[model samples]
Target: MSLAAAPFTSLPTPLPAPERTKTRLLELIKRHGPQTAQDLAYKLEVSVPAARRHLCDLQDGGLIESRTERPGGRGRPQHVFALTDQGEASFPKTYSGLCVDVLRHVQQLFGQGAVMQVFDARSAEIAARLQAEVPLSAPLPVRVQAFVRVLCEMGFDAVLEQDGDTWLVSKRNCPNLTVARQFQELCVSELTMYQTLLGVPMTRETRIACGQSTCLYRIGP
Candidate 1:
């Protein structure tokens, strides 16, 4: 699984040249694992001093940490820099790819019925959790807000909007996009889950899996 670089959280919106270099340094550590300043300097094509300065800054910002290690327990110790949890979050993950592969294997081995069972099981689990966390007994607006919050917590980037009496919940990004693209049954399972959680019939206005900008659900007044 290849790691794609994302904008650094520790840096400002408009990253300066030095900060951009720091971002690259984080990417290097993320892609290649722990590395010494000398190794990073060579990879980055910068002087040792410059690399050390960037490493120092990143360390201070709590993105990377260093520990001393000696090669094969011989010779002097060298400091090795590695990404912290915050640093690891600065890159795009390939979890969806792994999930797609697993689902594909399941379908190939046990057939489509088995795949449907997987989706149904996952949907039931999500429904149970939402039933527990969200106040389904509350008013529609309250339930909608809570549902959107839960979706955001699940990495959906969900938002709730109102157009007169109707309400729309939009998911800006689908975390399971890779899997949904291959097996759209996952989408039907999601829509069913939303209706079950909201206790109201909802219509999908647009679908990300269908190449729309967002997965939009409209709740009638």
Candidate 2:
């Protein structure tokens, strides 16, 4: 008998539907990991069978895995699914995770408390640094530019416009504004600190009518 050659196996390829489903599923998994099929279906806004079909595709693609979970008094155990290493790689990169990574590095450099203290010190240091750059006799517009630049450094998209000797500093974007609204006291404090540093007698008022999507700080002389 002649010996037959072994058949070559092809690598798994992700289909378009499976790819789209996997992308969304990975996002959900990153937000809430180790979910059951029913939970994933609800979160993804798809039917249970549809969710299962996508999940099966992802499993075959090596992007996710499932494990059995048994609750008390259950006839059969449920399978909880989560992203594989390959799955996490499919999602967008997050800077918050990088921030934590930096914190870990700082902890290594100094200590855990030192990292905390550094965070505390940063606001004051930032204020002082900006103060040093402001010219005492500069025009109001120039001073406003300096202030907005400092705010931008702190990850706020701030812009300044002058109208009749008054400066309006609008916060166009703030990545943390949604979660930090509860800490509005901190936001006001930082704004006050910058105003003091600039030696500008600008009255500060905030508008929260637009919800967290938009917040405004009206600074006027």
Candidate 3:
């Protein structure tokens, strides 16, 4: 996907420009594989010195590794850079994989109808799993707190907002939405199931702003 078409959380932010640059460099490596400094400079449109500075920074961050390359009759070796496991983590590939993993698991459970039942089932499963990790004897709000924490750990920017007698469980960002549009319904159903499992009476409203571009799940009790 074009950078502009990426999910909201994947969008480049104004803050942390240096870290973002390093991430962009790693993305380039992941996309094009290994490359020398000159290649990176030309692709990124930066001076050789500036590219080297960013490369060094990324190396320091443990996101990339460099190895010496020698041509058949080269007078000197050049350093070629590529992504390391740690570096690859900075990109959305891992999150995309997680999305696929979850969907696969859901498909196994619900068969061809997984698209319909998987979301709610997964949410219920997550709630059950999380209950084991935290003290469950607490009040409803405390339990919801535990649920939100688990959601955040699972890479959802989940938040619970109070609105009078009801609570709104909202996710501002989901990393998998861009590449997994077929599974968008899963997110909605899962969020709905989360509300049900939380023992809160809730109403769900789903809004698709564009064709697989933006999805909003608003759940309120």
What lDDT tens digits, residue by residue, belong to model 1 across residues 1-221? Answer: 99999876785468889988999999899888889999999999999999999999999999999998786789998889999997887788788888889999999999988888899889999899779777678998888889889999999999989989989899999978888999988998888888889899999989898999999999865
Model 1 lDDT at residue 3: 93
lDDT of 3 by residue, 1-221 (tens): 65666555665547586666666777789988888888988988888898899999888878899998774548688779988898777666466667777777767777857666655666677667766645546677776677778777877777777777656666556655643466656656765666655655555454332343223333333
Q: Count clashing residue pairs per candidate.
A: 0, 0, 1
**Judged by lDDT, which candidate is best?**
1
Candidates 1 and 2 compared: the better one by TM-score is 1
- Candidate 3 residue 167 Cα shift, in angstroms, is 1.5
The alpha-carbon lDDT assigned to residue 25 of candidate 3 equals: 77
Once superposed on the true structure, which residue ranges of model 1 sit more than 4 Å away at CA?
1-17, 31-62, 65-81, 89-93
lDDT of each: 0.90, 0.70, 0.69
The collision pairs in model 2 are none
Deviation of model 3 at 210, angstroms: 6.5
Per-prediction TM-score to the true structure, in the order listed:
0.67, 0.42, 0.48
Shift of residue 194 alpha carbon in model 2, Å:
2.0
Residue-level lDDT for 180 in candidate 2: 41
Error of 1 at 55 (Å): 4.5
* Deviation (Å) of 187 in candidate 1: 0.5
Ranking by lDDT: 1, 2, 3
Best by TM-score: 1
